[model samples]
Target: MHQIEKETVLDVRGLRTEFGLAECPLVAVDDVSFQVKAGEILGLVGESGSGKSITLRSILGIVRPRGRVWGEILWKGRDLVPLDEAALRRVRGREIAMIFQEPMSSLNPLLTVGLQISENLAAHTDLNSKERKARAIELLDMVGIPAARNRLGDYPHEFSGGMRQRVMIAIALASNPQLLLADEPTTALDVTIQDQILRLIQALSRDLGMAVILVTHDMGVVAETCDRVAVMYGGRLCETGLTADVIADARHPYSLGLLRSIPRDVAPRTPLYSIPGAPPSLNALPAGCAFTARCPVAGPECRDVRPSLETTGRQRQVACHHREEALIHFSAREAAQ
Candidate 1:
């Protein structure tokens, strides 16, 4: 959770993404803003359908045909939003790379893992075929794949779930991207394997000086791996702060609910906590706060006005009309305990 003072590698401002018909589009991400610094790991966390993945896809320029994305995505002070397809091609996989959630579906079943890595190299680099092959093997080895040379011809199905995820990481790193986008990279792995993958990613970020944006629903993962975190709900950021700060003192109710739900140090046989009700539908969101329906402290005013994300401290932000009251309540509860 250390905040590095390196240069900002990526700055996303007012990023809005929408999909569906031209007349009746649903906003998946709404005016979301965040920053990632060189060699820093930033986590985007929320429940499913909270726009975590959509925000990452928008930044990678991989949104679907019907999807519309707007706002500035600045990479090293250069705006990437308006870049044409060809220009984006040069940026994608080279300047920026993404490792998807499901490795089984992302990797090619027919192609050798080495071949896939070589393909990425072939597309983005000037390395000759021989050099590319050599680099591919090196990448596999770097990602801890056993018998890299012999596994060059192995298909996706030949590898286990954890190994497949490593292969995905190897491919993403083939281009030496400055920014890495990992969407639920550890979702399918067992607990032990998940720890390995997360540690590998954290180590890779430090060693390669690569900035990373990790999207996940696991609060434990974010707490253990990220320097900072952004909590999203209903297509908007509910809270953002240093990982330790937000986890220890969550200002937004949504963030507080998420932290409280985690089974940490509770007595044995105690029922697990959970946020009540479901997230609001993006297509038919209420005019007021999207979280009003599920918020325990929602008042009449909460149903009539949406609160913008406001700065609560030097390195914290939250969106809630009763932020002050919530802070006081949390403090009082902590004192009582």
Candidate 2:
């Protein structure tokens, strides 16, 4: 683990995203705020439908038309939320790029991998056709594709699952983006291939000085790759801090439950810890704490008011009515076991 330099590159402030124009609009992301510094890898960890993916999409201005988004997506102090389509085009690929979960789907089956990568360079850079083609080959080589020159002409279906993912990464880095949004980049791969992709992303971020936001449900992946983490639940960030702090001593009940669900040194066939109740419906969320129904330590006060995020410790934020007591008891319980 290396020390992260604290110079904010992307600052998301008070972000709120919604879906539906008809009755009963759903708030998928609510008042989410976070910052990514140069070369930092921030992990957004939560179960499916926790707004992790929506929050990432909101930053890149890729949310669908039905999805209403408002807030500041500050890239180097410039707000992207108000930027028009043409202006956003200038910022999207060259400044920020994303590697989606499914690479085979993200890549074009009709086009050669080289053409797909060079398209970004052609659109965003001043490079001529020959130079763009050369750069595309270089990107393919950089992402560790074997036989880069020959493989450049291959279509998405011509490559293996991991190879297709590598092609996606090459295209994403074609414009040399400063920020990379990776939405479950390794979810579809086997464990061996997942480790390889994670290492590739880590190495690329270090070599390129690119900030990264990795959105996934795998806490183990977060532990292995992230510098800091933000844990979301029911469209709200429940806890956030350094990876070490959040994993070892989680303050929020939801975060704690997530950590406990990871199989540790327990006996074989042991049932994993699962949080009670399903995630709240965004279209009809409860007035008070969205997690109150599932939280084990919930009390009367938790049901009366929605808890806002508050500073729980140094560089740690938690949204819970019982954070203080929960931290103390949770820490003690872990120590005991």
Candidate with maximal lDDT = 1
What ranges in model 2 sit over 4 Å off?
A: 1-5, 22-24, 325-337
- TM-score for candidate 2: 0.95
Question: Between which residue pairs do clashes occur in model 1?
Answer: none
lDDT of 1 by residue, 1-337 (tens): 9955699999999999999886887989988999999999999999999999999889878895668899999999999888877898999999999999999999989899988999999999999999998999999999999899999999999999999999999999999999999999999689999999999999999999999999999888999999999999999888999999998888898888888788877788877778899988887786777889988778788878988888988689988998767677656744664
Scored by CA lDDT, what does every candidate get? 0.91, 0.89
For candidate 2, list the clashing residue pairs, or say none: none
Global CA lDDT computed for model 2: 0.89
Model 1 ranges off by over 4 Å: 1-4, 327-337
Measured with C-alpha atoms, the lDDT of residue 220 in candidate 1 is: 89
